[model samples]
Target: MSDSTTSIKTFRYRLYPTRAQEAAMFETLRLTRTLYNAGLEQRREAYRKHGKTLSAYDQQKELTALKEACLEFSGVYSHVLQDVFDRLDKAYKAFFSRVKKGAKRAGFPRFKPATRWDSFKFKQCWNNAKNDWTACGKPVDDGRRISIPKIGNVKIKLHRPLEGKPKSLQIVLDVDQWYAVYTCEVPVQPLPTTGSSVGIDLGTTWFAVTSDGEFIENPRHLGRSLGKLRVQQRTVSRRKKGGNRRKKAVKQVAKTYRKVRRQRLDFQHKTARRLIHEHDLIAHENLQVGNMAQSNLARSILDAGWAGFLFQLAAKAESAGRRVIAVDPRYTSQRCHACGHTGKENRVNQASFRCVQCGHTANADHNAAKNILDRGTSTERGEPLGRAVPSGENGSGVSHAVA
Candidate 1:
């Protein structure tokens, strides 16, 4: 495959560091976080006192002197420390970009608390040579362990075989457990064409309904784990703050939530993979889920995770050489697919749909899926995207030409 590798994927592996190794990693974390906070304060102070913003490069150039002064900084790898400044630089740049766009929440970069800053990255892991990792970071001892600069070889559980060339490594802390996340570049392996297309209607009650009459069920991952979460939360409340017992209780609560998140993520990945494998062209509504969640049904809408599913579907489709099209969602639910009759009366209820003019009845989600398919096909035929044509006795609908 001469095509340039465009797909950048991430892989996570559970790490089992010895107590001493873990302590060293924690030291690295503390040093990097302190550096980040100090850099932020410098920028703010410079701007407030001199009306001049301190750029990342300006602070990065001062690293050598800071390391010489602070003996502890010399203990950590230089590249790892440098990454901290680079990350803060990105945060500041993003904040400014958002403010320029008049975003609602142009949040300034704030100092990260100990609990919030759970990860540290090494800027250079694998050298430019393919499959060759730098001495600072590499999978050694047959992938069972990884070498980190400050911390010695940490035992790792390589659950899945690593693919692609590793570019960087991130050490992450989830509650009390440690993980190594690898960023890699892999060439795409296109799947065989399926020669089929389908439109999907996503809902809270049901995960998805396809124009082909397949109904996908929603697992309600968070809803199912609510009981355990409630119990852990209650335990956390019973313990006094700052106590080791309370911290443990908090971790318990976080563990349950983590499991729920993983479950939801796994479900989305599998569903997206299946859709990509089955359909050459998959169509769905271009839903503004963020805006949709601003109402009373926010909990259900968020829990359904329609946005996550669509994102996964699109990404998988791209890698598989399939097409994913998003159609306008305006009247898909209310309009009658059978007669192209646009009216709210067509929606008998959430699950039922009936066209008054054509006397056509079907499941609401199924009808919407059909309408999405029609819209998507028209778009592929060079029709205006997101345009809904009204059709009735006046025959005001999109016309087709025979080949």
Candidate 2:
């Protein structure tokens, strides 16, 4: 089987650390950042003076020397610092390769400061004594604790019991919050085929309309919380700039925004799981959300969350071994699915569609979903399909198919 068919799962652990532990973690981050910058400097000097390309091993050797030099500043070198250099080397090589292939825009790699050290890594190996699992860094006796090599045991809330052998572990710090990410290789039992398919039409008002006649109302999380958000923003603005009160107010606003984001993500994941469980194949429009978000109706467009919904749907489908097909949206709303009649007169309003030629009336979004389903099925059967047309194009509505 292809690597894509192999089952890999990720579990996130929220770390609860004492004040001293948090300080130590931050110090480790600084040490790693210092090592990374020193490695980058060595590469630049080597390139300029001797025209030598520094490999990861070469940078790692230099990192050891730099760590010794900074012994008085920090303590003994940690494996995390070496891991950071390895990651930077990999990133540099990938960037250059992409540039050479015209896949990435040309740009020079810049140095990262200690304040920006986001994450560090560890590896996991099977342990026979426990006959269960252990994280690469450290194994906590109590299930709630995780051990890292240099960093001692840290408490974590494992929301779910982990399954399978751990392959890698990453300790990431984001917005002053710490998270432990575990990547594992697990055996996946095949899900019983649902033998059903669905085509979804995404919109600004409703999150989605399914060909099966289901409507998922848009949560509008951002819009719903806008009033409170504005109040918080005003509070922050009114505070004396650079003062502790202003800083506290800013953090409060950040927390609110973060809550909304987390809620939206959770909702999307649950919705995707339900759809994936019910459908053998799923079809959705390949919306150019980035471009759409630039339009006058950007706020409403973002509220719809077309991109986020599609991303969740695609990921769930992949993990379930189901197919997700992207069909050109085009005139899906205006085209009559029953008669294949296409015209501007069909879509009478946002909520209603009536085919002028065939006199077939249906809900605007539902008709669009039916058209999407037809297109998806046709494409799966190896039929020729039209491509997507630009939004403002005249009567010619093209549609494109993608896997």
Candidate 3:
């Protein structure tokens, strides 16, 4: 596909809506939830009785009938419900295809209501005229806005100028906060190619160590906020269940956790952007983040967000037209980067490493980073390398190092 046709990027903007707008959003969410659950029920019953799965086209056909049956509810075609049906049909089709290919576990789908639907709203398309977006349901004239269909004018933070044609827009709610996500079709502008390369080693103790001898210290956001979180948890635990005070306390705790997540994501995006911009070729170990999350140090491991970091890095590198290479991570830390000798005794402590054969000394993570860079460079040049061999000590498993 041409770059112009294939390139797309999503931008998220926070939303602040009036009380009336909030109510409308809640109604939209409620209708969508009902439609989704009903569709899910249809799929489940079909499988239970006839052992048949619905294809995307088939689900769409069924949904058309369902909508026709609900024509009396004028708002059923208000664009929001239509989008919900479209999404539900697409989801079932994808899920069944996965099951057929053994990519997912075989199971019937289930249905759930939208008790919390009042928390959000959505519309598929909208138009903008004179900085105001108009759609079917209601006309919004907020100066801070994005245009969408059927949903009319919606408010947005407008933090940055939009760069491309808006292809899709979604309004989402998290806790009591609202946000807008816009998927835009952007023209590809690949960065000028260069021969620069770098290797990275990710750790739980430190966020990341570069082959160039730079370390990104772990912020440990969760660890830092643990005391405050514990106090909130204690207060909630002491409240009577189902009481208004208990619910309020629960929301406060959830909001705190969400804040930590948001901060971590922001940090990852910045770090990934910096790395992709600095190097033409990047190399790092391909880590199994899921496996790491199950380890004894899972809390710290999750906090470092190795998987999220790699995901962001890879995505940004792709957009920038940079090469990201994953090489075997086995023995990268234990092996001597200078002498090509591998031994367990090389990593003498949490922060230090001393090669037994070459007697080269460096920080453990730094040494690992160098090895990762070497492996990536070799792989890019078509050199053969052995699979990662697990160190067996410190429960570290060797896997593909992703750049």
Candidates in order, TM-scores: namely 0.87, 0.79, 0.80
Cα lDDT over the full model 3: 0.71
If candidate 2 were superposed on the true structure by all CA atoms, what would the RMSD be? 4.7
Residue 322's lDDT in candidate 1 = 77
Q: Summarize candidate 1's per-residue lDDT along 72-146 as a digit string, tens digits.
A: 999988888889989999999989987887767778999988877888998777777564779755878988898
What's the best-to-worst order under TM-score? 1, 3, 2
Stretches of candidate 3 exceeding 4 Å from the true structure: 1-6, 71-143, 385-403
lDDT of each: 0.84, 0.75, 0.71
**Mind giving the per-residue lDDT tens digits that candidate 3 earns over 1-403?**
2263346677777877767666666666776787777767776777899999754456555655665777533454445555655676666666677687665354444565543443223443335454433343222454366544434466767787665555556777777887777666566667887668999999977899999888888878888889999999999999999999999999999889888988899899998888888899899998866655766989998998888888888777766777898777878888777766566777889889997666889999998998899888888887776444534555333333233
Which TM-score value belongs to model 2?
0.79
Instruction: Please say which candidate is ahead in TM-score: 2 or 3.
Output: 3
lDDT value, candidate 1, whole model: 0.84
